[model samples]
Target: MKKLAVVNGKIIDVEKGSILQKNLFIEDGKIVEVSEKEPDNSWEILDASDCYVAPGIFDMHVHLRDPGYEYKEDINTGLRAAVEGGVTRVAAMPNTNPVNDNISVTEYMIEKAEALFLAELYPIAAITMGQKGETLTEMGLLAEAGAVGFSDDGLPVENAEVMRRALEYASLFDKPIIAHEEDKNLSGDGVINEGRISTLMGLPGIPSTAEEAMIARDVLLAGYTGGKLHICHVSTKGSVEIIRWAKKRGIPVTAEAAIHHLTLTEEDLYKAGYNTNFKMNPPLRTEEDIDALYKGLADGTIDAIVTDHAPHSKSDKEVEFDKAPFGIIGLQTLLPLSLRLWKENILTLPELFKKLAYNPARILNIPGGSIKVGEPAYITVFNMEKYTFTEGMILSKSKNSPFIGWKLEGKKKFIIVKDKVL
Candidate 1:
């Protein structure tokens, strides 16, 4: 590959926890040099003036819905949306038509994604076969087939014995078992969060206990079996408390908070007139929960910020509030919404990037989150400014975001993956 220079940008290195105004020189898809003075006329220069250049964003949780619900999202469109949001890598969930429990399904997704070549995709195979929480999948075989981790994301592994066995098995391979952390009995037929909003709206509620109880069980299991346990979309204060306690005891546990959970509260549902777009699993929590989540992120209890980029067709989300499916398309809004953390003084710029880029990569044990010399040239440039988000700007096949017309801060200007500018 030809040498390329990204110049005149404030480079933020999360690994170093430092930000500096410097130029990066890339050659053969890897960063070869960083300098204060630009190289001679031999290099192709990409101007990044008035913007922040950081490691390419890595979203550890996203549902591509390929090989099954392509109408809602496919590999091509979903990856394109990831580029628009400054994400160069993502971990696709396994809850598809034929769940990614076997090696053939995992190989299919790997080949299809390699053909697209827009972003690096890591497949997270299912923990339980068919996601029924009954039998465990072939964990060793799936991992050997390039699965970065294991998770039955859309559905929590409900049986404690099954979960314990799955974690013990996954530990042999040093892979994390990402838990969805919900008790079906506790969440019984509940559509929204169980709190004041659910009461006022006259809708069934999913209490915070539903999520906390499951997290508590999983934490203990991780401690008992020495398994790496990762909590997905942690949305409750009590859940944070349990994970924090587990970490204090030196248990191998890590957790992630979704962008929506950190930014929106249950009150947003009432303000938006009960828009179905705001609904999601582990639904938009209370303000206290949001505060705890932000605090968790600030203190490193929450290891990363994930999109949980669940997409649905308009037909799926346009019905009555209770009838609508749970989830919202979030790929395009991840950067803008996460920028709110820095804007609100919850985390500094470098600290925020640590959660967005380095932390997730470290948890998944994947490449492409550093801007150091000899690292692959995966980078994102964004201008922190005021802009309005609109449905027309959405690049995903599904336009199910709640931030459609909202004015937001920060916008990505360029996305470069493996030396190819997108």
Candidate 2:
């Protein structure tokens, strides 16, 4: 294979929290060297003098509504969106039409990703059959067929006994049960956060207790079963405290926070005139919750940052706030929105990269989140001050994002994954 060299970029060492100017050399899909000296002229060159080079992003939660809902997003389009956002890998949630509860569906996703060969796609199988909250799926079989983890995302596994059994079963395979923690009863008909904002708009609210209550139960169950539990899209301050306590007690638990939750708040909903694009499950929370999330992220209470990139068509998002479906597409907006953390000094550059790249790879037990010799060539290059984001810049099939028209601080320049530059 021909050798590739990336020259003059600021290489971020997330593990060590440092940044240094270095040139990288790659051959046969693995990095061969990273040094201050320029590489030989025989190697092909990719200039990065104006950008920062880091590990390609790995998003642990995404919704690629393929098979059943292509109009929203399919693997082909969704993976492209991921690549466009400098993401080299993503863990797709199993909430498709046939509900990925079996081996066949799991294999299909793997096979499809292999065929496309853009960004790496890891499948997360459904926890229960049909996601009905009744019987558990074939965990062993699903894992054997390439499922990275299990979750019934978009729908919480409400039955306590079922969730307990699922946790126990998943523990046998050393896999995590990605809990979409929420008490449906408490969140019933709620469109946004349960607080002054919801009341002022005369809309029903989804209490923070709904999320914290379920997290409290699952953390206990995970401790009792000794299972690896990963909580998804953590939005409440109370939930963060529970996870910190669980970690302190040495219970195997990890949690993630979405970029939207970190940057925007419930005040954005009113500012947007109750636009559906600002509406999402676990809705944009309050400033207090956002503050706590930042603290959790900084202190290691939150393990990773994810997009939860739920795509919806124009018709799906054009309805009234109460009638429209939850979620806004996020794959393309993750980096720019996340850059706000570094821009505001909430997190240092390396610290932000840890949440975006290293932690997600560790949580999913995947390869390719480091810039080291002999490591796979998964790199993302970006210029922090050169670009701006707009609605027209979205590459996804859907354009339902609150960040549209906002001037973002960073721009992705190149994505190199497994010897291929995209």
Candidate 3:
């Protein structure tokens, strides 16, 4: 690949723990140098004067329903959505029509993703066979097949012994056990969060203890088994507090607050008579919980932010809000919502990049979260002043994003892959 220079932008090296206003030189799909003095014209220049050029964004949790559910999303369109969302890399959840439970299935996903455009997709294989939670899948083989991590995702390993074993085994490969964290009996047939909203709406409610109980148990399991545990799509204030307490006590635990949980409250569920878009597992909580989610983000209690990027068809979410599938698409809205946090001064821009890029990359052990020399040329350029978000412009296959038609500041202008920028 020929050398190329991206000039006149604020370069934020999230992993390097610094930012610089300079020109970046890329060669062979990796950063070769970063210098303040724009040198002689020996390379192609990508104009970035009005943009913030940082390491490509990373989403540690996204459901790119592929293989069995191509009608919803495939590797092709899912990746396009990822890049359009400024995500250069995503660790996809294991829940699918036929779960990615073995080495062969995991390998097929890796092979197909390589033949596509947009951000890189790293498959997270299922932790159990069929996600039944009875027997553990072949961890070593799956990891060798290029599995980024392991999770049951939609289904938590309800068996404490099974959960404990999954964590212990995954530790051997240095991969984290991503727990969905809901006790089966507690969340069974539960709809919205167990609170006033559930009572007011006449919907079944899942107790916050449903999530917190599992989290508390998992922290104990991690402490006992000596394994790394990561909590995904944490929604409850109780879940947040447990993760904070566990982390403070030095348990190997990290948690992420979902975008919707951060920005929206139970009030959105009541809007339009309990909108289905507001329906999600660990369902939307009260204003106090939303405040706690923000507090978690600001105080560094929640280690990262995740999209949970679940997509359902129009028919899927068109059902009654009570019966609709859980989750809303957000890979496209993560950055802008994060910008809201930044604008409120709850999180600095560098801190925003750390949650969106750096910390998640560290947790996943991926390498695209920095602008340091010799790192892969995964980068994103965004306009700081252009505050516009239009509907149907997102590149994802399913347009079920809750951020639809909601205006947001900050926009990604272009991205750099290996030899190309768009």
Candidate 4:
């Protein structure tokens, strides 16, 4: 029996919203005990003094660009970056070159991640064939092949009937249809949020209504069909109010706010003088949107926080702001950036972990989110160590992030995934 003990740590009880100083004992990848009792000499010890031990973060929204965009980020490099960010499980978005719309691509991603033995990878299959937003893929077969959920993340399902049918169909498998809520007609050729900044910069804008309108439609569809719905990268105040109203009406819906959306705004983009790194889909909205996101999070309207960790190669982002792809690499900065929420008292420690670790697991139906006996021992140990986020700190294949020079806190000391310590 392989035995290990994590000692001298402040273990977070996400359920009770409390912390306890306990030592965690693991035997053959399963947590065998959680107490103050010292382990015998036979068991290996992993010290966690002065650090908080919580369940490994499960980032449900990430683009690991493998099997096609390896130049940007393959599974190996992506998973390594995930571990570095204190994440143990990730749900990869389906926007590969051929797209993960079939069983083969789904299985390939799972097998590749398993072989690496790094952070667990769950594939989110495409909602439409080739993600064209018309015909639906064989979601049942893809789910059977190990797809945890379905999504057309990089694109929105444009047809209302198609989306309604998708919601109804996905409900059959009890999987969430993660909607990338955007109306192409409203956001045509837009490069940033539709407001003062865009007008001043002479750039087209992606109106907040483009995101809000689709979210409203989908939430209503979810209510009508009783299908599970998870909104992706919600960035607008109106979007939050819509989701909150949906939940009040008892719509089967959940939502996430990206770290960038929760922190940065279009004003930051304007300040940066049209930096492409600040550019992303559902482009950063106004500070008013950020405040609403916080309110939504505090009130439980927003269910989780995600990185939307889209990575683009240097060559891919070295273009004019409008010509650049919409995303910035975020795996390496997720922890520190998110820790700001807890440090600022926007959320308590357990509340933060609920969004970072617990909620993602619950939303994706994955086997993680807590530390307890008889559970898989996937834990992240970290301290509130201040540090500057630099290019050297990024472990991702791509070096495209706006937070490269930001000073941040919360460093991961070690992450225990099953029986392996990283």
Who is ahead in lDDT, 1 or 2?
1
Stretches of candidate 2 off by over 4 Å are none
- C-alpha lDDT score of every prediction, in listed order: 0.91, 0.90, 0.84, 0.92
Clashes of each: 0, 0, 0, 0
Give me the displacement of residue 275 in model 2, in angstroms: 0.6
The 10-residue segment of model 3 with minimum total lDDT is 383-392
- What is the TM-score of candidate 3? 0.96
Candidate 1 wrongly placed segments (more than 4 Å): none
Per-residue CA lDDT of candidate 3, range 259-368, in tens? Answer: 88888888777774767877888788888888888888878888888899888788888887767989888888887888888899888777888888778878877676
Candidate 1 lDDT over 200-296, as tens digits, reads 9888999999999999999999999999999999999999999999999999999999999988898998788779999999999999999899889
Give candidates' CA RMSD values in order.
1.1, 1.2, 1.6, 1.0
Best-performing candidate as measured by lDDT: 4
Runs of candidate 4 exceeding 4 Å displacement? none
lDDT (Cα, tens digit) per residue for candidate 2, span 85-182: 98988999999989999999889888998799799899999999999999999999998898989999978999899999999999898789998899
**Residue 19 in candidate 1 has what lDDT?**
92
- lDDT minimum window of 10 residues, candidate 2: 384-393
TM-scores for all predictions: 0.98, 0.98, 0.96, 0.98
